[model samples]
Target: MKTGGVLLQQKTKKNINITIRNLTISDITHQYCNWLNDKETNKYLESRFTEWNMQSLLDYYHQKNKSELMLAIIEDDTGTHVGNVKVSAIDKNHHRAEIGIIIGDKNLWGKGIATTAIGIVAEYCFDVLDIHKLTAGAYAENLASINAFISNGFIVEGQRKEHVLTPSGWSDVVLLGKIKSQE
Candidate 1:
């Protein structure tokens, strides 16, 4: 089902069209639920480790916590629900937050949509939310994810050795950070 959610913000490019918007109740579709369960699509995601139920998602949505901002990532031309970008784990005292993205549409992989999504969300985190810094982490093997953040002005800050277990073996976590410019 189409979210028909209000367009809170956007960032566009020739190969990528990102509509940053709030998620709606209608977004709880079978397609949305399936993405979380798709092993291949979620291989690099932390969510892949847990199971998601529709009712549980709905409950979480209704809880109305203000610590995070979750935005829907919609493909412009096809109006497909490709994924979501979120700025969560906010620390107001530190003026920082963490960001994450999940591009559920495997067909759109290798495209620049993920990078554009990060740019849009990071802009919001810095400009609108007044966050001084934004941080994210990716598995050592997830080059695409690392590139996306790097292209959006993030830099590798540190690495956590043997952070997560993968099929091959344990992998390090590449920590990334981007600070808002004083100017």
Candidate 2:
């Protein structure tokens, strides 16, 4: 598991300063577990299928920390852990990876935190990790997530019709991608 160290920082348009850091086991708490189990928060997330408890969450953290970059989004002003951004499915030989994000704090929604976090992490993937391409997918109804990636220069690459099963029935998935600038 990666130690908890601030990896990136940026200021959102709303003037909220946030930082991204390697998530540690200690970061897992009852509140964090609640965020995952919350219906509205995890609606578009695959994790919604599973019930999340502290033990299960810890197990997940252990598994993901091994192969992917699991980052925590922290509100710098109040020093609170607000959410997470994951860079997973990393194909080193192909220089590509998939990015996923969740802003668990409902009160913090629509504050440009997702957009800013995605931007910072995308920069790290391209410049620091030497990843050539980054991809993300969102449920068709998840305009907030799609727009967040779009705001950071990701283009909608394609859409998979009826790609995922949801509570409301099958839903389309919007695929978005961004290539590292050559310059």
Candidate 3:
């Protein structure tokens, strides 16, 4: 657990050798920028509505916010950066945060990496950060994300009617959340 400096915490899954660590300046690469620009990848993301550029990415990486934690998902075997997971909008007083994940590697989609990372981050939120609950929202049509959250113990808490406007028209957003187990 690298708790000080830029790194917050580290987690590695033995089954897939996938590691999650604090996102650093060095991790801001062209591939990541491309992911943000890729329509297919960003279709369901709110950021898809914005144009992405190197400068914007640099600014994003440099921005400081105490209430959010962004992490990079790495494939330990090949040293490949696969995706990102973010726990943001943290309300420390309320012990809660909003979580989101983006697995940029299309090849790695459908794998259980997102689920594993979500579980690890949720545990970190509860056991390390002392957060009481975690929340996430996904487009109603994003079954993969919904399934990943559910498989990681999140439950559908509610739905926002036509929360987002897509090219296909308005789409609902499913709200999901999980509370730290009182053990």
The global C-alpha lDDT for each of the candidates, from Candidate 1 onward, is 0.80, 0.93, 0.84
Which runs of model 3 end up more than 4 angstroms from their true locations?
1-14, 64-66
Model 1 per-residue lDDT tens digits across residues 1-183? 112233644544555666778867777677877888888877778767768779866776566334467678888777777888877878878988899888888888887888888987787677777889999999998999999999999999999999999867899999999999888
Q: Estimate, for each residue in 91-166, the C-alpha lDDT of model 2 and write its tens digit.
A: 9789999999999999999999999999999988887888999999999999999999999999999999999999
Q: Give the TM-score of candidate 2.
A: 0.96
The lDDT leader among the candidates is 2
* lDDT (10s digit) by residue, model 3, range 19-99: 788888888888898899898899899889778777888787777333468888898789898999988878867888889
My TM-score estimates for the predictions, one after another, are 0.88, 0.96, 0.91
Which one wins by lDDT: 1 or 2?
A: 2
lDDT of 3: 0.84
Off by over 4 Å in 2: 1-6
Model 1 residue 115 CA deviation in Å = 0.5
For candidate 2, the 10 contiguous residues with the lowest summed lDDT are 1-10
Give the Cα error of residue 27 in candidate 1, in Å. 1.1
Ranked by TM-score from best down, the candidates are 2, 3, 1
Give Cα distance to truth, residue 27, candidate 2, Å.
0.9
